[model samples]
Target chain A: MDTKTDLLSHHISQQFNNELEELRNNLLSMGGQVEKQVSDAIEALINADSEGAISVCEKDTDINAMELTIDEECSRILARRQPAASDLRLVLACTKASTDLERIGDEAAKIARFAISLTEQGEAPKGYIEARHIGNHVRQMVQDALNAFARFDADLALAVAKEDKSVDREYKSATRELVTYMMEDPRSITRVLNIMWVLRSLERIGDHARNIAEYVIYLVKGKDVRHIGIKRIQAEVFDQ
Target chain B: MDTKTDLLSHHISQQFNNELEELRNNLLSMGGQVEKQVSDAIEALINADSEGAISVCEKDTDINAMELTIDEECSRILARRQPAASDLRLVLACTKASTDLERIGDEAAKIARFAISLTEQGEAPKGYIEARHIGNHVRQMVQDALNAFARFDADLALAVAKEDKSVDREYKSATRELVTYMMEDPRSITRVLNIMWVLRSLERIGDHARNIAEYVIYLVKGKDVRHIGIKRIQAEVFDQ
Candidate 1:
């Protein structure tokens, strides 16, 4: 997939253009790895595949490396090219987006680690359905967030932000049910708590995806749409 | 407090140096706000002070706004001055640090939310002592991290990293004990889970503080010390 967002507005210096282009591509590359890590981690948890989970853990280093590389490129471009206006926003967004992606990757590794630990103690009585349901939603959110960045689509990014609300709702409801189940059966608390942590990680992944989307909105619209509600973001970003 | 870090060295442009200086000071100011939020949130939890918790929640917006403002200034300095070498690292570090401080503020708000929830549900049978213990430790870690950035002290930053290990250990042991308590007394699971979440928030706060400290190491030592273990960061960073 071509990762260039075409957000760059044709620089005179071909070298500078290439530097900006490479920065966006590298960020998307990191995003792809993170999206896969999240997907594989959820799969590992559902299937009780410890090896799969460990592999997810191992691949995290690559994502971390990608973040450092992309961040360095951002600084390099800022220092060398002194990019202004749209170009500066792109660099700033890439720097912030890479951090968000790395965090999403970290959360995925955490879910995978939970999978490994869960495998050791054997499967639980409940919560895999909740995991799969919320897992698919969050995975899509992460993927869509990256796509939003790749295409520079604030509308799609807005959709990602809106989906986070639903994902969070599902997470809270699932945790409440699990808490009730634990109260009914004391033996299941530990395993259920592990599942709860997985749910928590999934919820957090959705949040980081929302963050990336927010950065995209800022990139394209040049507005900081955070802390404001969806209605305000809608009115602010698209209206202008 | 003077937040310059004195790490800028001798830049030719006094205005550029002032911009860098203001960025650092603004970041430290944001950090100060975050530190207070965490402390207040923990205090609210221990005292069941809903008003105090609500204040922490309210103050979060200010921190969030501060993050955007400082981030904007970082880009401004990057674009206008196009600082290189140590100046470039300072800008990058400021960008990353603001994000960490914003996240730390988010975690504090989360803890405050938990505090408010716990107030509605009434106090749990266990976990307050643990909250007090880990809360103070994490609060100290946040302060030390900001100081490390302010002073450009890698040694102090390393100490913050090491302290995180102990904080995690304390957190894990507390959660384990709480888990045991919940299992033994099934009725306490809900309240205990709330306290557990407060601990989770505290743990994440420690992680963010450690991240800020790691960025300090990078700014001072010009090394990316993430994912590497403590001893590795210790030897690689301080060896020179």
Candidate 2:
């Protein structure tokens, strides 16, 4: 076998293999934390739980710290092990995925801030219903994407990538509905805008999830599926 | 000098040095394209120029293509050259900065899409002024961040990071103003929401620029300044 194929199929060194496994474990840990944060942030909005929202904001620092730590580990592995081919791809994917996880944390924090604002204003409005629906969908995407990464399941990753379109459609519809409500009664604009921002954050969270899924596909298939149309990705994944 | 320091201070190989330079140049090209896209997108919104906005959308594919190319080059260098120390840091930073630049392109496209929607609906509203102001500031941040990357100037990177705070403030004021305007005239809610999305896009672009600046700091000082408080970053940069 070629050196790269050998490296991929067999461990170059036991310590190096352990390091790679540790990196993946760290990423999964960070992903799990972010998923919980997203769910909690959405719950805070739906239940108008300002205290819960504040606690979510407080948790973001820990998530951010985890990202930095994972990133440092990736850099150290690249420098020390000098991994090639598939190993290099795995390290690169970990680095990129951690960055996305951190941003997902930021999006969840934004949602929490909105929840706090909505609570201060008064009762959560009708828009909270739509926010909850979209938020749930996004949280699922994050979970599935992480699962796909854990298993190196290209099929699951492609599925997660495809789900982003429905989230976008839901977000657009929600925005339209919220805008109509605001036009009917201008006094509700402030509250509606808060919900709108929450939906926007959910939509972005979905995007980040899709990015992670794309990274998973890259890692498994040795292909860069980013920027490619979903149709093409589907074709490639199915063909494989 | 020690081996690591010597590697940092001298080229590992002439070809590797050229490849690194090529990566930076590619990033700068992507940055320049994104800067123009941002400017054009804002101008389209302010002037109600749907055609200009559509053109900006068309140009995004090129930026995405550039990002993929640079990313491949970085991966290739990592697998082949196995660069360590500062060199490895540089490649990692490029990989990240290219991702940010591509997302900045995505943000610009979102702005351009908003401009198109506003044109179809009616005349641009007062919020366009705020959007243009914020857009200009964000574009400048992208430029300054790219300049910092080009020169490896940690001071300029820190400055760019600090500038993000003002952009955030401006974004908040703009959102508040738009909401108030919508409250005053319910009929304007649709147009006002469009402008608000544009402002949100600008704010996100500022965040990406700040991220690039952080990468520059990391590249120069071997410090991962991400997630640290700006106050700490300021102290660190100045103390050096």
Candidate 3:
């Protein structure tokens, strides 16, 4: 098998392989933290657990720190090892994935903030079911995207992108429903607007997850599947 | 004087300097393109110029292509020159700056799409004035952020982040006003929602600019400033 068949399987030296493996492990650990934050934030919003929401916001710093460390590791690898080919792509993918994971953390924190507002305003939850549904969907996307990266599976990454489209559709439909509720009640505008913003954050989280998946595709195939249509991505990566 | 006094002035080899210089120039050129896209998108939205808006959307591919080229050069430099110290920071910053610039272009394109939708819906433009006001504000931030990067001026970069706070305030205020309008005339909800989405895009553009400015600070002072509050950032970058 070629060196790239496993990407991280073999390097010139065991030390280099250990460094790359450590980097990937650190990245996955960070992703796991971000995933927990996201799922907890959604739970807080759906359950109206303002204290839990506050904790989610407070812990965002840890996610930020993890990203800084990941970035440093990426730079350290670049400067020290100067790895080429699949190794280089692996480093680049880790760099890019860390950024997306950090952004997903930010979006989850945003949802938590909105949850706090909902609790403070003492409004009965307007869109909790929709939030929970989309939240779970996006959380799964985040998990799967990370799995794709861990396994170097471009096909699974493609599926994450496709699922993002469905999240977008759900976001839009939920938004439309919220807008109609605001129109019908007029008084519900403030409460509904908060939920809409939360939905937007959830949708953006999905986008960041999709972005990570795209980076996985780029890492494995050495082809940029971004901004290109999915059919084109599939054709370029698999069809050929 | 230290080698970092003028980061690009002297390196081990003159050829390395030229490569780094070319990379910086390419990044600035890409930034200029994104700056124009943001401004043009705002103008199209404000003026109800759907044709111009369409042009802005169509041209996003150019910005995406530019980003890819810059990223490739970053990888090339890392693999070949293995830049150290300030040079390494410059390469890392460019890799990051290009990503933010590309996202700014994406946000600008989203604004343009909303503008086209606004024209198609043929509403009387409920938030054009507010949009123009905030659009101009954020566009200036983008320009100044790029200028800071070009010069490695940490002080100017600080100002860009400061401006982002004001832009966020303006966004919140504009959103409130739009919400009020929706309450007053329920029928206006669709148009106002359109405008709200545009305002959000502008605010996000401002955030992207601020992120670029933070990268500049990191490039110059060799500090990570993200997630740190504005006052904390200033203290970290300049106060110490």
Best by DockQ: 2
TM-score of candidate 2 relative to the true fold: 0.96
Query: Relative to the true structure, how large is the alpha-carbon lDDT of every model?
Result: 0.90, 0.89, 0.89
Candidate 2 residue spans exceeding 4 A from truth = A1-9, B1-9
What residue runs in model 1 are displaced by over 4 Å at the alpha carbon?
A1-6, B1-6
DockQ, candidate no. 2: 0.90
Tens digits of per-residue lDDT for model 3 on B134-229? 999999999999898888888899999999999999999998888888989988888889989999999999999999999998888888898889
The full ranking of all candidates by TM-score, starting with the best, is: 1, 2, 3
Q: How many Å off is the CA of A55 in candidate 3?
A: 1.2
| Fnat for the candidates in order | 0.87, 1.00, 0.59
In model 3 chain A, where is the ten-residue run with the lowest total lDDT? A1-10
- Candidate 3 off by > 4 Å: A1-5, B1-5
